[model samples]
Target: MDRHKVYISSTYRDLADYRARVINFFLSGKMPDSFSLISMEGYVADDIQPSDKCVEDVAKCDIYILIVAKRYGFIPPDTTKNPGRFSITEMEYETAVSHNKIILTFLADEKQVFEEDSDPDAALLAEKKQKLLAFKEKVRLAKLTHPDGFTDAYHLCFQVQQAIFNKFFTEIYASREENLDKIYFCDRRSQNYTFQKGRQINKAIQFFLINSHEKDMAHFFVKRIGLECIESDIRTLDLFIYPTILDNSDFDDLEFSMRCAIKEEWNRNAELKKFKLKDPLDVSVEKVLSVMDELNYDCLIISWEIKSFYWKNDKLNENISAFYEKYDQVNATLKTSKKIFFIGTVSYSECADMTFAQFEDKIKSIRYGATPIKLTRINRNEIKDWMTDFEIEDNPNVQEKLLHDLLPGPDPDFYLSDLELPLRNILMKL
Candidate 1:
């Protein structure tokens, strides 16, 4: 079997733990035979320049996965051959571009900032941050599909899985193209509360706010809406449209990013080729609705991530509402459209001061008139039940032993944030 080589690129010391989580998934999780994740940890050698070796690895991969945080990373020597002081990560990106590799990019949310190069000088640190932000902007504008925020390890792996599946549809299934949506090919190995009969899923619900932290189990339910919405007969959502906030982008910028992702998706999809999508400089409500009117799918699932958006701040609201008229109408289409369902995740620190009602009132979001699901905490029974439901580990004694391994203080009740790392370790070996 020929597996896809996915290069995971990021600054090493800052995001070491994050790299480990995603690497574990591609190494030993459910589909290890089908895909492999490549990173610096895979091999070590001082015989070669790190930049040259990194670019060499990127050239071999079928896909490139780039995760960027606040660090500008190691700067290789500038020479006449390659004349700029680009970070090794940037060099690998250039290699990917030259090779025309399929790229899936994830940017860190605003709250996940790292000090650049362990610098103590505040002025120098700020300047390096500007460089990082500039690189992020370059990455965003260069691709038809915009880069998304990295909320958690599970979301990273799932995004990679979905993106690869969509891009290499024929290769994954040995050219059985019809099995695209019909197949539920992998297990839900993340620390999600499932496998019990207690979930009250509403298949008809098309819009909602998920009041869960991005680091917790909310992502699982978001993916569930895409997969398990049985009443709509959607085997799987046709495309992923993630338009996230990054750097200094305003609300209008976010909308434009979303439109670009959506337009590119429809234009690229063979079945949806008849309908044309247009890009206009001015985002009028009419133009947005016109795009919506062109949507021809029976059902579609779209995910939105908003970070560094202080909804409760009157000053920020003032800046946002000026552009709100157009977005208000555009979001309305998704809210009422029978063919669409959306899952939204917001930055935790940004919204901490606001209540649910405050969020609803200030954002005027697509979450209007829908029930939000909270996935913060789960008990011991849910974990054991999830194991049984997926047949991950069948023995009862083993289940308790694993629970002890997963949580702290000998308590079966655990926060999903606390359970994520250990559970991912188990799933890697499962």
Candidate 2:
């Protein structure tokens, strides 16, 4: 097994016992063999600068564990350009943050006051308490999640074990990659169909659906998707649906419905019930690029009705064009390793002599190295036939099967296999 180096950061004098307990917990037989804890106590050399060495160790570590207690720790001399005076512990955290290390923070229980009345410097003690509270508050407000509080060394040990286990499960075991496999599904319509297709490939893929529609519709879609995943026998899945609503009129209700759906569906699966499900993240379509950047998605699957992108000279159609333009720009700026897939479909009734030409031109305009797979003219009769043939009871499953049949294969004229080959190749690699 590949070993992971975890750097421990905390006030040495105040949290020495808690830190020792955490280290010992990992060193015990219960912990996995892949993890090894590192702290300043393990450092034997005195000739090198302590602060520099701390930063170096933090940079090299695979994970950073920060424990916040009552003390502010020993403030090292200001040797760098940073204006704020940070202790050796804070410096280690800053180094970890700068290097973009995975940080796990454990806060000491606020009920227990570590400061003693017999302390020599009362004012200094008060200052340290204020600093510690402020630091804890700062961490709470940060983007990182899972900052837990512990009552004592035993409580801290259990919390540490749980946190590390959850992290390893989601980040490593779930994806079977160095980093989590994040897939962003952008669609104005219900994404249950798209999700069905995605699961057919990799059920373990993390899903983040961005729906630019009404809150009620988003709730309906999320509920449907959750139920489908549950019924499909997926043992564990990380799913998040963000509804892009303009107002907060129905946000609360939508959130409540989504939470209920997740809780109920997840309860049906014993393995999935162990993991905590977060509330639906609300975001606008305009912020899609920012969300993509933040999540660093491995694959982006964008599905849209071909009619929506048609040049109708209407404001909504123009907005759709602008959306693709932004997508093109974002894709151009992204690293080559990031895969972008465009799934375009048109109904048989919506198709015309100029439909193919128009769709081809629109795809070319939005082309920034995105693999475009245009589903051949689909009709109600063909869909019904497919559903009957496959004996699929669900509409979403039928739709997914129909779309899959439209992909390039042995048949050439009926499917755009040439254009879909590249996208299929990428999906296969994933």
- TM-score for all models, in order of appearance: 0.52, 0.39
Q: Estimate, for each residue in 1-430, the C-alpha lDDT of model 1 and write its tens digit.
A: 6988888888777777777777765664334366776657743221125566788899999888887777877555556435765677877788898999888887775564454554677776565677677788889887633345655555566565556545654354454432332222122333223322322233322444455444454555566555555545743444555553343566667567767766766566675566556563332434433444565334555555554333435444443333334433555344333344545555343234565556656555333334444455566776777667666677899988976755544664665544543554345445
Angstrom error at residue 11, model 2 = 1.2
lDDT of 2 by residue, 1-430 (tens): 7789988887665667788888876665444467886656754221124677777889999999888766666555565633465656677777888899999887775545564212357876576566666777777776434433565565576567657867774444344421111111111122444444443232211223222211112322343343344445532133332212111224354334443443444345454443334433332222333333455544434332222222343333333344445444554344344333433332121223345455344434442222322223323444344344433323666455544543333332332112222222222233
Each candidate: how many clashes? Answer: 0, 1
What ranges in model 1 sit over 4 Å off? 1-146, 149-206, 231-240, 244-261, 264-271, 280-298, 308-339, 347-367, 389-395, 398-430
State each model's C-alpha RMSD to the native: 8.4, 21.5
Which residue pairs of candidate 2 clash? 408-417
Error of 2 at 26 (Å): 1.9
Give the clashing pairs for model 1: none
User: How far out, in Å, is residue 424 in model 2?
Assistant: 36
Could you say which candidate leads in TM-score? 1
